[model samples]
Target: TSIRFCLDGDEPGRKAAAELMRKYYELGYEVEDCPPPAGYKDYNEWLVAAKLNLNRMNKRADEPVRA
Candidate 1:
């Protein structure tokens, strides 16, 4: 199984993610990096936005459409 590292887009976060990827690659493990969306600074923010979007979609789906 591959290992995924979800890191923030900040400088420190990017450096840490790079170091981890290098270390794990040297250890012969398949690793993937998942960064947050362009507008988001981190995963948590993106996650919240995604959840909110989902909730809005569900709410709209439950509403009756006008003729």
Candidate 2:
């Protein structure tokens, strides 16, 4: 089984997710950090954006993003 870390896509949220992933990894568990896609913040934001069929950028939209 794999562990997934679903968290907010913000600075603090990312850090928290990383910490959780690390903790779980250290415990010998496979972990995945699954945050919402680049622009969205959380699951709610992702859902809202998906429903509206629009790109929703969070507050940190200016920050660098993953490819």
| Best-matching candidate per TM-score | 1
Model 2 off-target regions past 4 Å? Answer: 54-67
Q: Write the per-residue lDDT of candidate 1 for residues 23-63, one digit (tens) a residue.
A: 99889999999888898989899889999999999999999
Which parts of model 1 are misplaced by more than 4 Å? none
Tens digits of per-residue lDDT for model 2, 13-62: 99999999999999999999899898888989889867665344443576
Lowest summed lDDT window (length 10), candidate 2: 51-60
- lDDT of residue 57 for candidate 1: 100
- Listed in order, each prediction's TM-score against the native is 0.77, 0.72
Q: TM-score for candidate 1, please give it.
A: 0.77
- What's the distance in Å from true for residue 37, model 1? 2.3
